[model samples]
Target: MIVVVDSNFLQNPMLETYFNESATNKVVIIDYAAMEAFKGDTLTSVVKSTAILRRFPRQVLIAHGTKTVGRLTGTREEIAKAMINDEGTAEFREFSAHLDRYERGVRPDGVERQLLDTGRWATDHLNAAQAENANLLDVFKELTDGIFTKEEISKIRRGEQEEGWVAKGFGLVRDLASDLLSRHPDGSVKLDPKDYYNNFIFRMSLCVFVQLMDWIRVGSPSALKPARLLNDRVDAMFATYGTYFDDVLSLDKQMLRTFWETDAILRFVYAREHEK
Candidate 1:
């Protein structure tokens, strides 16, 4: 069992005694970022509290702040040294830039609009087709054998499961695009769909890339190839929906990448893997 040592607990002598004497020796010290969230009386006290917490085995203490949360096991010392020495590595710099962009609301070209528009279009088409004619339902029924139920459609309308539609449509579009790309003997990329759709690939690509970044941050290099392959499908998705929803599909891939890389789980995994 992992134990989280907050500044409050660290400052209290009794709590510290209990903590040290506890059968579970695993204790992780919360980092400055997380400590900042506390509405404490003084920063000095918090810092002292953190220092006391860190007196344990360096490998047992992890950092848990607002923006950064990772096990301190092995990576903590290196990470601390990097911060103290101001050695901002390329990846760290890139991650910082991504966060800056996100904070400023700087998004990809048209990704947001495309998602909204596609969602609206799907909703409208499904509604109109269902009400006026049985043909739409028949088509869906033929394809899914009633697996896609009316309740599911209703849930989608309520925004309960909108991702399901996006996932399904994206999968279909990606498959078709893949087939086309594979057939091209010259290897010259065909009239890609994003150009027509106004950069739908940008949005889809960002999502895929972010997913990959998250996987990497979690120290799961084994998943890298599959993640990259998923990213490659963004081009195909663009081809399928680029014409219909270009403006809404442009997304800032860089920001998403940064957010995932900085995620707590990624840092935790990194710490676990590098533990001595």
Candidate 2:
């Protein structure tokens, strides 16, 4: 099994226990998790996390990989090291500069206003269309006819499953991903969607949320916390990508449950390839 770990779980203390418990699975680290580790206030603990990540037999993929001198280039340890000893590495310097910008809330094309904007856009459009006399809740039920039963829909509408239902798949969600979600199994859009099933279901959940917000006459978009938006997207990406692998490992209970749900959703939605 390919076990993907989250950023918050990259603590020095939990490494041995995690490895001991997952002695049989091939633990992997996604790029998002690695980049997040650089936020460590102490270089020692960050290095410790990177070292533990690299010890995995499988080379952890760094999608936004950095440059390092000599043969240590692009390794997890190198990424952390470059942050501390950037020296003259232009690539790592530029990357760290962006991190610096993010800390000051200047990340333009990043997660600065990621969830806030997305939730607004979704809620805005839904409200505008509802003003046109369209019943979107009916449309939502029609779209998720099989995935969520009618009883589940009623329960969610009653606010029972509202906690992590949106959060579970909210990270892999984007304007483009939602576009894919809206047009899926339709001939209107010619784009191909990502292979992860959570991507599809999460988008569906967003639509479900939009409907619920309007249905209950509640303003949920206004409730989205801007402070927690950054980490929300990060954790969302980890849980979303975890569906592509066999499993995800995380010390956080919420993230761990998301992993289980998304991975299980992937297998349930796609049988042959992911079936155990």
Candidate 3:
């Protein structure tokens, strides 16, 4: 089994016990997991030495998030194989080394600045989520041209919509098509939200983010502060890559929920495509 465990599971000591050194199952150490460790207690709490060293001959595959799509591509992962063969992976390995130095009081000035910047972005994301929560019913109308009724929006907020509903209910692909003729188009051709199954990483990331907004809208207890949501966004990265693999092992209910939701979306898209 190719298991993708988010940063949460990476820190859990039990992970080392269950999977062991020579287990057949492969545990994926996504690119974000390493970078995410920099935020909290450095490498000590986020990922333990045993998690990597004890794995012995069993290779810990590092999965990189989609790169060419840039921000729309979501998070990146890099495996050991890539670290050795791919030049891009080498850059991330340097990040790992710098993180190690930071832990030892040799702060990597460049990476440290990047961590500070994430805080600013998280605050912006928080503000946006709050605004969207307030206008979930109306804001979508702007893009969708009022085709999505208030009642339907409410149903979706509650996750009540049935399978294959989005694809059929609205000319989703057409509607989302960018009005490239104008700079301020309803959408951009940079990425297509339709047929999400085909763009597994982007789709999974989108699902996770939308779910966060829904939680904020409904006042779900699981909905946490901006920093936590930022962490969940990291989980989204892992979840996105997880969809392309076998399974995900995460402690956070929100992360697991995001994973399940992404899987359902993938299945629905596949079913819809088959009908044609």
- Which predicted model would earn the best TM-score? 3
What stretches of model 3 exceed 4 Å from their correct place? 41-54, 68-147, 157-159, 162-196, 200-202, 205-213, 216-225
Tens-digit per-residue lDDT, 145-171, candidate 3: 545556665666777754344543434
Question: What range of 10 consecutive residues in model 1 has the weakest lDDT sum?
Answer: 240-249
- Clash total of candidate 2: 0
User: Over all chains combined, what TM-score does candidate 1 have?
Assistant: 0.21
Q: Predictions ranked by lDDT, top down? A: 3, 2, 1
Write the number of the candidate with greater TM-score, choosing between 1 and 3. 3
Off by over 4 Å in 1: 22-24, 30-33, 37-43, 57-60, 64-276
In candidate 3, what residue range of length 10 has the lowest lDDT sum?
Answer: 74-83
- The TM-score-based order of candidates, best leading, equals 3, 2, 1
Task: State how far residue 64 of model 2 sits from its true place (Å).
Answer: 6.2
Off by over 4 Å in 2: 12-14, 17-24, 40-42, 54-154, 157-221, 271-276
Candidate closest to the true structure, highest lDDT = 3
